[model samples]
Target: MTNTHAAAADGAEPPQGPPAPNHESGTGGAGGKTNPAEGRVPTTHPHPKTHRTPDGLDAHLVVNRTTFRLDIKLTAAPGDVVALLGPNGAGKTTALRALAGLVPLTAGHLRLDGAELDRTPPESRPVGVVFQDYLLFPHLTALDNIAFGPRCQGATKAASRAQAAEWLARMGLTEHATAKPRHLSGGQSQRVALARALATSPRLLLLDEPLAALDARTRLEVRAQLRRHLAEFEAVAVLVTHDPLDAMVLADRLVVIEDGRAVQEGTPSDIARHPRTDYIAQLVGLNLYKGHADGHTVRLDIGPAITTTEILSGPAFVAFPPSAVTLFRDPPTGSSARNHWRCEVAGLETHGDQIRADLTGELPLAADLTTVAAAELDLHPGAPVWATVKATQTHAYPA
Candidate 1:
């Protein structure tokens, strides 16, 4: 939008632009921190399971307007956490809204458990949602907050409060049941939000950045707790998150959407091992290469071929973690690894204890080395280095 074309026209390739998620700056940490909870109450969720839905959580999502269009499909089963991962403006939320019945489907079918839900209104659809902000009522106690859903579903006031108590106890918020939303902590509020949604017992559960509001310390705890809850859920649960780590840990499978289209969909490990797009490649912090594998070696279209432990017969992918690459200040006269490349350090950034160096050469790649190694090589933004990767370190799978 800022005339990025001008830079490309001037002999420079366009930038990758801002990272998919900048939530770390405000509340979420740099891949390590998360957002603080915003207060709110909500309804049903899903769990993680190895089983697949034979019929799937069928959806042919279609929403059209003068400004944009959405056409996509998502199918999963009960107990499978399907993460919708993408950058902003990728229509991830739009597709979720369509399935939730908040946005009308211009033309498509939304079926869950063999029932037609697309034609139904949001309230009529037994779907639960945990929004980015945990919109809890400031005046209500956490117990009442969790119980609000059941009361709306026709339970008596006393029974609802009782059910809310049970849920609060499960979330480890029994002591804070009487506390108002303002009196609660971010992590507690998130649990309350999740509790409220699950109280409704929805056949389909939706979460949008569930842990995006927590800090680093709280994120670790909440992530583990959320994983437990998802494991407990027995219905269809779909979560939309920008963080790759969250998607991998919270969801059973991933459905990546970009520009309102389904770019890729597979198990988190599957997608991580064989990334088709640069976005997915960067998210997993891996050097991905598409190549042909035959017998003992895999060949890339680029400068060097990669050898792997597993021998494949056809098209395959060779991937290695950034840390697996070793950098040198000069071309090594002798090296143990067969795969080596000379590259210019295009950029460098600190990721926790190590620094990730983005290199430019025969092929753009990111390599991670410890601070000691980095200092030894005197790595800098424009320094040249020789990188070597051991054959045993490379992982190859069918492309």
Candidate 2:
């Protein structure tokens, strides 16, 4: 992290740290370019019969760098928490930075509460960013760190401190107001960083991997707290994270990005149940395949046909959980499962309390079984096996 980016400055700019690749050069001459597919997808995925208010966030961020290009549209209503979820180097941070005005847009617009902020400077925009590291000023006490934003916005010194104190109380950090950043725990520092971001009453809040810095034990507690806080927030909040759990738990909607573009956007449950891409399928722990559906079977592009309960036609997707697959040492003639494949165990790994076997041969798939079952079958790499999944367990959806 560079010292410039790591500085715990108020929203005048992003928190100081190591510079990001996409932020190296701001946009130039990007205004003339247009994305042909931008209109193909709707701006927001509102619940059935619900209408998104116009007085919220509407942004189509585009940044053209030498090595990367980010072109994704984001929209949210007040009180909506949207998560930009993807893998590393998928432009999640770039999208967050563009929204924060830290990275200029090459071609697209940013609007909040009916105001166009495409050209607004970081300090002037109505945005607050909580960095991944929770960059609290090393020299300042918790109270002062929270007060910094309001002070920079021209609030009276005493008034800012009072507001900071109120926030500290609200965050259950009143006892830590006098402590410096170094003296605070990871969770405490995160709360302080959140308090600082909220001190200025930003209309839009941006969080970059808000829980990435916490350990497993602390993450559980803080994640619950963060969810509550996000639920209570009245404005739009956009979170950038590679962790699927964080996105699923924190956001009302998930925008799945990959290679700098949005591949899917939907409610957490909807996305989990009907993943559109392999990346999302893996993230949600499903074995997904695209194929042509006929009657009750889907002929996958790569693997053998899978018989599903759903009767669909044309392009379709079939998905089933690894746990739904049952592996046998030999092919059974009287098995009731409608889908069966002669597969070879390619690898084995411990997944939670189960053994996940990655198999190849007639059909590639992952099967999850108990350690006892694995031992009974003597499962190992290169072992011949028959994998079966009940037709009722596979879900088929249109592609």
Candidate 3:
């Protein structure tokens, strides 16, 4: 099932929450202590002109077919990396195709390096794309595949191969230059694909699920390598993926798509801290509350008092990660944190070394604890538990 809904092509800020970036490796955990990029999110407000296009690549896209449609707006700076993140049917791929001119635009404008390209053909658009499968020709050697693009652009054959050799060496594929695509491992093939794309000298690069085909063990190593390559490339790069960890790790900003619309967009840390949709909430594992802020507290529907450092005076959001919530089989005393509720454990899920308990109480919330902690509490789906969270840890900000 493909999602053809319209999403925000224009980048914007996502809701705020506990610092998402500062979390550890893997998607997320209940009580992981370290974040790869600690404090990756900025706590300040955006400037009045914060939306200005970067490196002069401004794109507005609306693409439609009989069975699917996509609309989005985006602008990128010379070295900025933007990620389009969504579930399978979220229209991320359709949006990318629209920008590359692989699919015709029903409406909207695209400008790269100050030149309008909405009407340009794919070959003329100065854009490079790395497909999900690392679609190199099986018969062609890695060197030849890289040289293919340059040669097609009118460089002499020898010159093209020389340039190809240079790129292969740059990618640490020097020893594998003569190996055909069939002999290349997943990571090697990916590098060859990337090198080939870059050899075309695109001003904007589009990568679609660049690591989806690799085995689990390879994703981590390749991702780290990809991050370095993206950082070194002096141009805007937009990648599409569903993995929140990947977006947070590989990109400077994220555009979250749900059913075709960009429900939220921001830095990985921003989205992680404050997820706006139920989809995002589940993806990041947090209890998200939205309401008005006046004086010392934010009022919820079936409200509880939340104390916070932020004192915004109007509509706002309050959020906290599951690990911040403490659970007990029985109500416990001697705690300073103000918020608590008694609830039945609706469900229990085990992931890696931790257990996630979904609680149905006055306020429905999820709690993360170590397997040992869960065992210590003798937790089960039907068990009763008291849940608690500190007001100070519950982040609050203007909605």
Candidate 4:
């Protein structure tokens, strides 16, 4: 495979972690300086002062391709792990590349710790990356692989190896120091890749699908380890992944991107509880609807009105989980469920132990049922059914 790792410039200092940037000084003030800019790059439009955090990352990245454009504003305090989440072709990778300087910005600025990095070369920027594949040099031992960054930044061979050894020990991989990439297990290789990335002590760390390459069992163990490592990192970290579990577990905040734009951003629970877009709704496994709210009832723009526990007037959103929907072969009268929709089974698939039925009709939604329940109803594509949800099961929030 191709080598994609890059190193910081010579004589750069490892970040000392953050107390928080001092806004008045335009650098890490009382908070120890993480990565100080070598020199300022002149810019016609400086990053907005309101968004500048001298101990973190503040960027409005805009990359224009012939057929697609990615425009997203990302901001994170030092010690923050932010995830860019979306489906395929949703520009998550494009945003990561922009942060790494692999792709030039068509518009907007890239600033880290209040210094402009819009024009910095990839190799010169104080950033590190952990690619999906780890990209360890196939010919190098684990120790050499972790030492590569420090060596490139002008560390003496002995000093570089020593630093790499320290990282390997920290990652609990000292025993595997002499092992090559091909000799290490998936989790060990991932830890080696992470140690390599952190070995340079980058101010901004970008991970593109860090857990994508691991098997299920290995991913479980490695994900926990990665989370701990990320938590201990003192610099800003941006993670790109489509897996909701990874984003929810590893990131301090989430920016949900779709069609080259951010559709929603918030804490994992906040985004899961109140999704602003269908993509987010589906990612979090909730059925979301946009409508105008009057009191406790929201009349959807297209589907049937839903009654929610929240009393609000104006544009709002209603969401419920697939488990909240109870399907019936026939519409029942005198039911406690405040909302019911006649739907046709569009498709059926196994979602864990339950069968997830994709239904379409008055309201498009997903419903989960036990195998026994599905068999009892003889559920299949094109089968008509009634789906009911209690008002208490639906959550409503402002649009």
Clashes within 3 Å, all models in order: 19, 8, 14, 0
lDDT, candidate 3, residue 166?
79
Arranged by TM-score with the best first, the candidates are: 2, 4, 3, 1
Candidate 3 residues 93-203, lDDT tens each? 888777666577888888887888887655455667777776675666888776655544445567757877877877789999999878999999988987776665666
Give the local distance difference test score of model 3: 0.71
Query: On a 0 to 100 scale, what is the lDDT of residue 32 in model 2?
Result: 18
**Candidate 4 lDDT, 1-399, residue by residue in tens:** 001222223332222232111111112223212111111111111111223245699999999999999999999997789999999999998898788776889999999988899997565667776777766767778887766655555555677688788778878999999998899998898888787667666678888898998899999999999898787777788899999999999999999999999998999988988899988888889999999999999999998899999999999999999999999989878899999999999999999999999999999999999999999999999999999999999999999
* TM-score of model number 2: 0.87
User: Please, what is the whole-model Cα lDDT of each candidate in the order they appear?
Assistant: 0.73, 0.78, 0.71, 0.78
Cα TM-score per model: 0.81, 0.87, 0.82, 0.86
Candidate 3 residue spans exceeding 4 A from truth: 1-55, 65-68, 302-309
**Per-residue lDDT for 46 in model 4?**
12
Q: Report the lDDT tens digits of candidate 2 across residue range 1-399.
A: 122233224232332322211111111112211100000001121112233345889999999999999999999988889999999999998998788777889999999988999987555566777776775767678887766655554555677678778778878999998999899999999988887766656677888888999999999999999898788777788899999999999999999999999999999999999999989999999999999999999999987899999999999999999999999998778889999999999999999999999999988889999999999999999999999999999999999
Error in Å for residue 124 of model 4: 0.5
lDDT comparing candidate 1 with the true structure = 0.73
Among all windows of ten consecutive residues in candidate 2, which has the lowest summed lDDT?
A: 34-43
List runs of model 2 lying over 4 Å from the truth: 1-54
